[model samples]
Target: MTSPLHTTRRAFTWMLGTALVGGASACGLSGTGGRGVIFRMGLRTAKAPGEESPGEFTTDTGWRIRLSSGVMVLGPIYIFENASPLEPTASAPRVLQRLGQWLLPTAHAHDGHFFSGGTVLGEWDREVVFDLLEEAGEVRELGRSPGIAGLARSFSLLLQPPSRALGAEGAALGGRSMILEGTASRQETHVPFRMALDFPPPVELQRVDFVPIAAELDEGGRFVVEVQPHRWFDGAHFDRVTVPEGGGVVDLTPDTQVYRALTLNVRRYTAFAGTWEPA
Candidate 1:
């Protein structure tokens, strides 16, 4: 049987070709006349809508989670001039294009492979440690960078392990990319859990590529990244977590279903969103 990973990769490869052909008219190869602009960027964490408090939310499985602490290392943000080709807007043309790909003999040879061919509109290549429990409305400035003016359509970033240069913040994370301490309760079962994760598993899975966005970047602007940590546990099941014999905190590892679900969700593009505002 084909592994799920291989299946997903193969599907993505086909979608990639479809997107390239479908999005060509929208993302032309024409140059922007070398026009440049400087933009301010910021990042912040927010609770999913309807949550009563920061670091606190109830999962779909009836588990109520209250996190006492949360931290993450994220950076090297990139803005692309091309929108995600996989978007469902242009159905007829995409279907025709996909049919054409099906007839090509080289198509199967490119299965399970991927690449980005979009033009870079902006970037912030530095890593920053974020306190996921920070006030919801607070914005952490990421300095400024020069970029080409264009229609910003997609975003990408890397989730990095804490670096020593981050000083106390780095030390707090204990060399992990993310750390969360919290309590979860469902019905009569209550458990305290600590999850320290280098999410994406293989380390290189740190790169989150091509999240679709629609923003016009011109002259000068501000780019903002909002992270919703609560969504990271959307599919987690606290009831399945084994409680300690003496009532101690449970350390979540790869072996647990919660840990596995978190690893998959944290890398999901839905957990993060980016927008651009004109200055």
Candidate 2:
């Protein structure tokens, strides 16, 4: 059994019905005796593992960091049919289907990764936009698709500001992008800090590696997508973080090294996006 991760995903979702074989469309799921697949997407933080509740902590630089809100805009999730992702192929990532449109990547190499060798298993038309710092138990159900075919080896999606990666649900952020806010204390004095990361266009993760396994519809089975924010703050130094005179933190600005740490951490941790488990 794959041990369940504490957090889920900040991306797209689908509800495929059956398996995919030769000449089969990912949407052509027609399985029996299953309620399809339901993805429980949520966020996880850098709190000490096994700790029942997240707690304020002093960073390595002796600054106390307390999180208040953590939001992330992500989506347009894609699952690949690349069972043997280790081998390079001539197939690039593609949009298996759209409401009435079809899109495929014409470019061959992206950031040095070869997408031309993979098959798109399915896609969630709507992007999932949520606050990563919300109560984990309140995380939403991203999608409930039918049974999926092939043991997917890679998952991909985009990390963007609310401006891009529009959610088909029409429930995305009105104008704000991402909100990462908290309280930092130095010398027993508390300072408020908030970082709103809003990069226009969008940051795309072509491939997020995960365990390869063809999933089946088990009566009690569910697919979970976890986005661990703790990983995103990896190597971030709170002492280097700057705060305003009365309130707010300047480290939220994109130009700061503290901001760079957050981005680098997210990229490094994307590979552990998720895994399918059985009952």
Q: Could you give candidate 2's per-residue lDDT for residues 1-279 as a string of tens digits?
A: 221221123321211112222214423454432223433332333344544434355554566567777666666555555443332334643332221111232223333233432544444444556655565433355655433444456555555545344554223455544567787677866666667665343233322332233544343344555665544554566566556666655546777766777655554423235555555
| TM-scores of the candidates in the order shown | 0.75, 0.60
lDDT at position 204, candidate 2: 34
Model 2, residue 257: displacement in angstroms?
A: 1.2
- lDDT value for candidate 2? 0.47
Question: lDDT, candidate 1, residue 62?
Answer: 79
Candidate 1 lDDT over residue span 1-279, tens digit each: 644344332243344435434344444446552356788888877766787676788887878888998889887677766665433355558777545433422112222223343656667766788887776547777788766667778776778677677899688877898888999998888889999988433333675665678877666678888887777897798778888788999999989999988877776665678877788
TM-score of 1: 0.75
Best by TM-score: 1
Q: Rate the local accuracy (lDDT) of all candidates.
A: 0.70, 0.47
